[model samples]
Target: MPQSKPQESPARKLLNILLLVVGTVTFLGFSFGPLFQALGPSESPEASLVTEQLRAQADGYRAVLEREPDNPIALRGLIDTQLQLNEPQGAIEPLKKLVELEPENRQLRAFLAQIQQDTGDLEGALEQLQILHEKDPKDSQVLQELADVQLALGRPSQAIELLENYLKEVPEDNDVRLRLAFIYVRNNQTEKAVALYDEMIAADPSDFAPVLGKAIALSSATDENLRAKAPELFEQAARLAPPKLREQIRQEAELSAQRNQPQAVESQETAP
Candidate 1:
C-alpha cells in the first residue's frame, strides 16, 4: 500500500483554520473598507478641498493687510479672515481699527472684550466686561464673565460679591451658585463651598460638575477630620465621572488619606 499521508496535528489544523479565517476577513475588509470610509459621516474630500481654498484666501487677505496696514478694506478682510480662522489675537488689530473708525460701535467693543479675555489680559478684559456690564446690568453672560475674570485675577472676594449681588436678583440661577462655589473654594471657605455644592447637587443629582468640585475641595482640606469626609465625596464623583476622571478621583482620595496620617513621635529620654 502507498504510504499514508502524514496526519496534521490538531494544533496545526487549528493554525491553518485561523490563517484561512484571517485571510478571508482581511480580503473582505480590503474590499469594503474604502467604500465605507468614502460614504461615512465625515467631511468629503471635495468639502475639505474647499475649506483649504477658503483658508488660503484668508491667508491672502492677511498678506494684503500687512502691505496696506490701515486700508479699511484690508482691515475688514483681515477681521473676517481672523474670525473665520478662530485667531482672536489676529482679529484684535482689525477690531481696534473698526473701533477707531467707528467709536460708537458697541459690537466691536464686545468682540475686543472677548479677544482680550482669550489673550489672558484679565484686567483689560475686565475693563471691557465692566463696560458691558454697565451697559446691561441684567446681562448674565457679562456678569458671569466679569466675575470669572475677577476670580482669575486673584480677586475671589470681588467675584464672590458680584455673584452674591447677581444671585440676589436672579435667585434661581444655578449657574451663579456654581460660580459662587468655585469662588468659595478659591477663597478657602471650604464649608461654604461644600454647602453650595450640596445645594447644587440637591437641585440636580446629574450635575457632576459640582460633585467633582466638592470632592476636590474636600480633598484639599488641611484638617484630618475634614479630609476623612472626602472619600464619600470622591465616591460620589467617581460614580458620575468619566473613566479618566474616576481614576483621578480615586488617586486623589488615596493621596488625601495618606496625607492625613499623623507623624510618629520619637521616644524621650528617661532622665534629663
Candidate 2:
C-alpha cells in the first residue's frame, strides 16, 4: 500500500526555507544585490557578548562594507568580531587594511599584533611591535610586547638588550625589572637576577613580582648557598602575600626547599 504524504512541521518548514529575511536593493548601479545575509553565531567573545542579535548585526555590518569598503567603523567592528570569534588568521587582512587606513593609530596596530601573536604568527607580531617601538621608543607597553615576542622566539639576548634599555630609562618599573631578571636567570645570570630582585625588594618588600622572581631564580641556582636562600624568601613572600596567592607561595617554597637538597647520582661502570 502507498504511504500517505507525511505532514511537514512548521519548524521543519522554517529550517528548509531561507532565513534572515533576505531582499534585493539597487545601489550605485549594482542591481538586485543582497542588502544583508545573516550569518550563524560564532564562538568568539566579541561576537558572543551580544550573540542573540549578533548574526544579523554582523550581516548588516558587512552590508555597510558593500557600500563603503573602507568604512573604518564597519572594518573595525568586523575585525573585532572576527577576533572575538577566534579567527585570528581571518582577521589579518582587514586588520592590515585598517592599519593602512589609520597608519598612526597605535592601538589598532597593537590589536593587529596581538591577533598575530594569538594565532602563533609570532614573526608578524614581532614586526608590528618593532614598528611600534621605533615609533615610540619610550613606550613601556611596546617594549614589553617586543621583549615578549623575542622571548617566545628564544632570542633571550635580544629581549635582554631591549628590556635593559627600557629599564635604564625607567628604573622604578619593578614589574619590568622582574621580567628582565627572569630573562637574566634563563640566560645564566642568576647573580644579576638576584641583585635586581634585591633592588626591587628594597623598594617595595611587599610587592610579589620580585619576591616570586627571586625565589625562582634562587631555586635554580647551582650554588648550594643561593639555593638554600630560596625557602626563606619564599616563606617571607607567602606571609606577606594575599590570601588567594598564599597557598601558591607556600607550594613554591616547598619545591624550592626540595631543589636545595643534594641529589644522589648513580655512576655507570664499564669495562675499559
Candidate 3:
C-alpha cells in the first residue's frame, strides 16, 4: 500500500480552505460591498419569465403582510422573493418591521442588515447592528459583525477597540482573536497585529493561521524592522501548513517576502 499521510489537526485543516476564506475576505469584509452576488448570469434567456414569477410571488407575500403586518412568515417571504427579483430596496422596510417583531431572531437581524448593505443604506445597517450589539453585549457573533461594519465605514480604530475589549472577556476564543488580528492588519497596526499573532502561535503551534496572518500584516507595514521579519514568518507558515495547502502557503509566503501581500484573510466563523 502507498504510505498514508499524517492527519491534520482541526486548526491545521482550516488552512486547507483558506483560499475561499481569504479570497472572499476582500469582497465581503465591508458591509458596503454587495453581500450576495447575482445568483445566475444576468442575461439568462429565461430571466424575464423568472422575474415575473418572483414578482407575482412577492405581490402575494405583500398582500399577506398588509393584512398582518407582524406576520413573520409573510414578512420573510416578501424579503426572500424581492431579493430573488434583485429588488432589495422594496424589501428593506418590511425587513425592518420583521426584525422589530422578532427581536430575538439573530438571523432576521443579519438578513435585514445584509439587504440594507446591499442597497447602499450604510447608515441604516449601522443602526440595526448597533441595536443588536447593545441588546446582547456578550454575543461574540454580534461583536464581530459590528466590527466589520465599523471597518467598512472607515472606522478601523473603533473596530480594533471593540474586538480587543471583547477579547479580554473571552480570552480562549481563537476565532474572535483571529478576526481581531486581521482587523489590526487591515488598519496598519502592524506591531499589535503581529504581537497578537505571536500569542496565538504560542497557544497552539498546530495553527498556521496566525503565522501566515503575521506575514500578511507585515506585508503592508512601512517599518523596516517589521518588513524584515515577514519572510521568516511566511517560511514558518509554509512548513507548518497542511500538506494539501503547503504549496499555496509557500507561494503567499514568497509574495510576502517581496512585500506584495494578497487580500486580507478572514475567519470563516465570523464571515458575514
The CA lDDT of each predicted structure is 0.63, 0.67, 0.70
lDDT of 3 by residue, 177-233 (tens): 877877776666767878888999989887788888877777567876777777787
For each candidate in turn, the TM-score is: 0.61, 0.72, 0.76
Cα lDDT tens digits, model 2, 124-155, are 88898899999999887578668867877889
Off-target runs (Cα >4 Å) in candidate 3 are 1-47, 66-68, 258-272
Q: Which residue pairs of candidate 3 clash? A: none
Worst 10 residues of 1 by lDDT: 28-37
- Residue 26 lDDT in candidate 1: 23
The window of 10 residues in a row where model 2 has the poorest summed lDDT is 18-27
User: Which candidate tops TM-score?
Assistant: 3
- Candidate 2 collision pairs: 44-84, 44-85
What is the alpha-carbon lDDT of model 1 when measured against the actual structure? 0.63
Please list the residue runs of candidate 2 whose C-alpha ends up more than 4 Å from where it truly belongs after superposition. Answer: 1-68, 258-272
Alpha-carbon shift of residue 117 in model 3 (angstroms): 2.3
Give model 3's TM-score versus the native structure.
Answer: 0.76
By summed lDDT, which 10 consecutive residues of candidate 3 come out lowest?
16-25
